[model samples]
Each structure stands twice: as C-alpha cells, then as structure tokens.
Target: MNVADDDDPPPIVVPEVTVTAGGAVTEGAGAVFTVAAEPAPDAPLSVNVTVGQDGDFGASTGSRTVTVGTGGTATLTVATVDDDADERDGSLSVTVDSGDGYTVSSGHASATVNVADDDDPPPIVVPEVSVADASIVEGEMGALSPLEFRVALSEASEQDVTVRYVIRSGTATDGLDYWGGTGQVTIGAGRTSGLIGMNVKDDILWEGDETLTVELTDADGAVIADGRATGTIIDDDD
Candidate 1:
C-alpha cells in the first residue's frame, strides 16, 4: 500500500520573489513611491510596501504581482513626489521602499537664499552766509575797488538775498549826482563769494568827508546788515 514514501518527500517546492524601489524626494519634504514584485516560476506571490514620513507609495503596473519564467528576472520602477513647504530654507530628501527581496537607500541635498533691506537717509548740513572785505574808501579813485569785496554762502538754499553799495557826497551846496548803475548783487547757495562793483562821479570837488555804505537785503527787500566807509576829498590846491 504505497510502500512508505521516500526521497525527501518528492523535493518540496518553494517560491522565489524580488522587489525594487526608486523615486525623487527632498529632505524634510514629502514623497510617494511605487513597488513591484516577481513570483517564482508557476508560483503565486504578493507584494506589500511601506513609506517613511512625508512619503507615499503606489503601483503603476496593472497588478502588483509579476509572473517569472524559468531563470528570468523581473523589474519595477516606483514614482515618488515631495510636497513639503517648511524646507524653504533650502534642504532636500529622497527615500525608497524596501519590500520582498529589495534593499532601500536614502539621500539628501540643499540650497540657500537670503533677504535684506536697502533704504537709507541722506546726510544733513547747516546753512551759513557772510561778506568778505566789507569796507571800501570813497573818492580815492580806484583806491578801494568795490569789486574786490565778496559775499560767501554755505549749503544750497532757495532764499533770495541781495547786496547793494551806495556813495553820498558830503553835505555841500553842490551835491554830486551820478548813475552808479545797478548796485544789486545776488549770492548763490554753496558759493564762496559773489562780486559787486560801484562807480562815482563828482560835479564839484569838495574837501569834506564822503560816506560809502554797503547793505544786504532779504527777499522782502528788508535791510539785514550794513557797513560804512568814510574818507575826505581833498582840494587839488592843497
């Protein structure tokens, strides 16, 4: 009756399986993966895979199981996606799923970005103004050229100012009268000095003191500063 079975129980049959995983990923980011498996020749098989944090796995082939032929190999490609938003500072991570007879390996990469402010204020300075060589002699005939004096200004400004010079003969029966021309001068901002000249003519030569007055005016024509110079016109007979 079936004479005691022998020969290692007719060589027990076993199934062979293989799995491979791969995909793109980022550090501190999320990703998805797909897994595939191959079964031993003429044997039934199944594949199960797991994903790491921020990781996902899915199958693309119609089925997760693959039938293998005699002495043949099976292959499967996994798809992964990263959705992490916190890694904006610049870091990346990639992960893979290991199932069946497969090995898993992970890697990371990174980049950097910077931000800054670019606004600043301009420097400040004080405004100043003054006159140089403020005095001049009278009737001396070029003894004191009015053009030699000047007005100085510091820093730019829109303020309007004028310089004027006048000469009046001493109180005499024959007071001298002459066209001194325009005695007005304008001072430009940031300018070291501005020049002004004067001309005088005498109808009668006198032997008394003559007065030369220099005045500075504001935009409203109001006197702001005044200087005077005096000298005597000697008679030629002396």
Candidate 2:
C-alpha cells in the first residue's frame, strides 16, 4: 500500500466565470447582457450566458444564449419590447455557465428604461376699449344737474372694457376743450346696453345755443363710436 502524506492538500481550483450589468438603459430603452471571464494561454474556453427578466419587468421574458472564447468576453443582447407610456422600474439577471473549468462568480445585474411626452396650447384673447361723452348746461353757479347718455357698442363681447372719453365743445370749425372722465366697464356676453353720466359744472356752462361732439374709443385708443348733441344755455341775466 502506498502511504500518502497527511500534510498534502488538493490544489485549490478557482472556477473561471463571467459577470456584468447591462449598459445604460432608459425605462423604455432596450438592453443586452455581457460576460467577464478568464481564458487559457492557448486552449480556448467556451462560456454560455443567459438573461432573465425580474421585478417590475411585467410579463416580459428573455432566454437568449451566447458563447465566449478563452480570454474573451461575450455580449448576449436580448431584444426587449416596452409597452409602458411612463418610465418603468425593474431588475434583470444574467446567468453564465462555463463548461466544467469555471464557476459563475457574478451572474446578476439591474436595468432601467425611461419614457416621456411633450405638447400644450395658447391663451384666450379678450376685447377692450375707450369712450368719450359731451354735454352743454343751461344754468348759472350751483344750478346745473347731471346729464346721462348711452353709447351703443357695435358688437357684443364678454371681455372687460376700459373707456376713455374726450368731451369737446364748439362748432365743426372751431374746437373747444371741455370736462371729461375715464372709467372701466364689463359687458356681459351678448348684452349691449351701456350708460355714461357726467355732471354739468356751473362754471363751464355755455350761454346761447351750442353744439358738442363726444368720441368713444377702445383700450387701444381706436375710435369705436361717436355722437353729437345740441343744447341751449339760458343766460342768467335774461
């Protein structure tokens, strides 16, 4: 019988295996598996790798296989289909089987794919304006009363309106500056009635017959409407 030395131990064998995580990928983006391994100096070693879907990977499966030679790495790209509109979160695994000489050291990794959308609209345009009103008084100090008039709007609009009034006096030949006021008004959609009032100042009262013109304008200073009225002011001395 041959006697074996008690101190002799079997040579330690380190199995050659491959490990890797799929490259950068988006929620909806596709990816493949890769292998890292050790190869013999001259003898070629073959490695087979498989990829499997895991976690939020929902209903999708990958079973692709690839072969790698000694001192070489193999990449097995698994075709992937993404049906998600939003970003998807999940994990995948890779298994490497090296015939006999190696054991898989690292055969698992994680993957992610992203998805997105882009489109939107403009704001609503509103209507706006300016207005002018004029009047003549027939009284002395403290005797004039307020006068009112209606300026008809051409079209009915829901937009908030601003009116500017320029009251002018005199004939069609000579223009005279008179009193006026500015204000804001809202016309309900399709409603047309608008009223403007002015207080006749005793100091600005005109004696005898007079003619006045009122100009109505929009917010942009564009003339939208106008009116002319004649009034007779009685002289206090008469």
Candidate 3:
C-alpha cells in the first residue's frame, strides 16, 4: 500500500497593508509615508508602522519595521516637533501595524498628515498717555504746597498703565484753591513715567497766578495721548 501522491502546497499569500500620506508639514518639517503592499509579496514583507498626532502638535510617535520588498513600496519618515506654543493646526497619522506578513486594510488602514503652524502670535502693545505742565509756589499761613503733575508714557508698557485723573477748574479752586481730586495712576511694569500730586493752599490773600486743570480721563492699557495739564499757582504774597 504505497501509492505515491505528494504535490499540494502552494497557497500562502498574506499582503494587504496600506497607508499613504505626505503633504503639508511645517513644524520642524517631516512627513512622508507610503507602506503599501497589495498583491506583491513573495518573500520580503516585514510591516509594522505607526505614527500619530492630533492636536497641539508636537508630532512624533513610534513603532517601526517596514520592509515590503518584492517591489511593493516602503518609505516612512515622520517627525515634527517645533513647539514654542501658539498652537492650532494639527493632524498626522499613518498606521499599518498588525504584524507578521501583514494584513490590515479596512480602507487604506490609516493615513493623514497636515500639521502646519510655524508658531507666531505675540504682538499687541497699546501705550500712550501723557499729561505734563507744572509750577508751584504758594506758601505762607498754613502752607501746604506740593503740586507735581507729569504723567507720561509713549512706549514702555508690558502692562500696567492705568491713568484716570480729574481736577477741573482752570482758575484754581477744588476744595478751595487746590487739592487734587479723583485719581488713579499706575504706570509700572517697564515704566515710562508717573507722578501726580496736588496740594496747594496758602491763604494770605494774594491770589495772583492761579490755574488748575489736570484731566486724563480713562486709560487702562493706555491711549489718551496728551490729555491735559496745567497747575501753576505761584503767588508768594508780595
């Protein structure tokens, strides 16, 4: 009983790993993928590749091993990490990882690369607030002189530049000749200039040179440019 019958062994074709993605990549610049394999796998296949990213983009994931010979196609380079922040612009994925010979195509497995966002967003200052004009000398008889008014800032603001003053009455006379009313002046954080003090009340009678008007009126980050200033009250009783 030995009827020679031996000849039946030729059916082992497992190759269906697809993933192709390349275009739009600027963060450190790197994205090129193609790990195909459809019907060309007679002896060199390997396969196992993964690279991912989807948001905030730092880009660069792992998983390697891609041969795909028999002239099927194989090239995968994915790297992108140029983060300084200013985020927004992400998308990068190329996967075909199953293992052993390959077979993972549900519709091209997975592929997408479009990360673009070079990083740029920082610029917006807004600073300009001025008010200067002064002269003070009115003392004798309960004297209280102090009159200083010079609040400027054309540029030099990282932040903190609040100015909103008011002391109207060009002929002097706020609480009865002078006493700076309603105020707010910060100007600090790189600073440009700041000084606003007013207190002059010397009653002896000789009211000769009198004037008072300091108005800046509202300013947060700053932008009131040369509001208004004039304080002079020099009448040394003579």
Candidate 4:
C-alpha cells in the first residue's frame, strides 16, 4: 500500500508506518494496536513505538507516543504480567521499532500479537464424611423404598454444603423400624456424594432384626465429614 500523490512534486511525500492487532487477550489483560501513519496530507507526524519479545508473550516490547491524527490512525497498547507458569499460547513482536519523523515501510512495518494464558486457580477442598447401610423386609405393604443413607466425601467439595442429619435409636422404634427425620443434605458444587432418606413400614407384629442410627451433625459450607450411619430392618413373618 503506497500512497503519496499531491501531483508528486513535493519529493514524493513518503511517510510509511504500519502495525495492527486485537483479539486474544488474557494475562493482566490488555491488547490493541493499529498504528498507521502513512503518506496522506503530510501534516501531523510523531511516532515512538518499540516492543519486541520472543521469549514468547511478553517480557519486553512496550512503548508509545503516536499522534498521526488527521485520520492517519494511532493506537498502541500491549500489556501482560501474571504468571504461575503453565502455558502454551503466546506471541509478541511489534515494530515501528524506532521513531524520529517516521520512515518504516516495506510491508506495513511490522505486527504480531496473539496471547492468552492465565493459569493458577484450583485449590479449595475440605471434606471427609460417610453414611451408608440398609436392609428391609417387613412384609412389604406401603412405602419401603426409603432406607438409603449414604453421604460420603473423603475430600472433594470446594463449595456448596449443607449437611445436617439426625435419627438415632439403635434398636429401632420410630413408627416401627424406619421413617424418622431431621433434615438437610445438599452437598453439591464439586461434590463428593450425598443421600439420606429413610422410610420402611409394613408391619403386623414380629420384631426381630432392627437397628437404626444416622448421624452427621452440622455443616453450612463444608466441614463435617467425620462419619456415622447404620440402618437395618428385617423381619418378614406371619
């Protein structure tokens, strides 16, 4: 792109400067460059843009003082600094390399910036809980699919926790052998496991094997996974 015509009598009017970029940003986030001080009207000129790095994606190449206003365009910005080391996407190299009246043309001078990588975010897991045990056979009759106590998390629940349970009496007796409550169990968001719903009753009279106890008291965001759970109701007779 060569443009210099005022009837070509004014020494050819040469003022070439080129660079452009935008898209692919992250890492203290900041990227934008479109410095084009070509040979147009020949009025405003002043360029000082030098930034070049190949260690890959920022280590140098950042400086600016462009004012080609009058439609010649002038905008340069590239900034990134934040590392925890874990990368595989980086690039940087912008030139107008040196400035003084400007004269950098042979293919728009220079430009290349495509960066995106900000690693280090994953650490917050506190969990240790387990509750699971059940067996039912009370001559089936009404509601018996309940008796499934299992709340486990040895480690994995970095957020969202509401575990609170109670139902004790190891010798069974709460309407018979199952169907006792004291609520709340929602362990989600990077969860580890959760489930507690007891219900078992279809009796006439014959109590043989019965034991009940499910305990895991308190947790409003995580930190109550120490353990306790027992459920068994077996007595199907005539």
By lDDT, who's the top model here?
A: 3
Kindly list the per-residue Cα lDDT of model 1 for residues 153-189, writing each as its tens digit: 5544555545565443333222342224336666654
Q: What is the lDDT for 216 in model 4?
A: 81
Please report the TM-score between candidate 4 and the true structure.
0.38
The residue-by-residue lDDT of candidate 4 on 1-238, one tens digit each, is 9997766454655667787876767766667778887664367777777776554555555665667766788777777776777677676657775566667777867777777677755665566666777666664546564667778777676677778888887888887666787887887878788888878776677778788888888877666645576888777765
In angstroms, give how far residue 225 of model 4 lies from its true place: 14
What are the clash counts of all predictions, listed in order?
10, 16, 0, 3
The whole-model C-alpha lDDT of candidate 4 against the native structure comes to: 0.72
RMSD of each: 19.6, 12.2, 10.0, 11.7
Give lDDT per model, in order: 0.36, 0.47, 0.83, 0.72
Candidate 3's TM-score reads 0.42
**CA displacement after TM-score superposition, residue 40 of candidate 2 (Å):** 4.5
Candidate whose TM-score is highest = 3
Which whole-number lDDT from 0 to 100 does residue 28 have in model 3?
A: 79
Alpha carbon lDDT at 178, candidate 1: 24
lDDT accuracy of residue 84 in candidate 3: 86
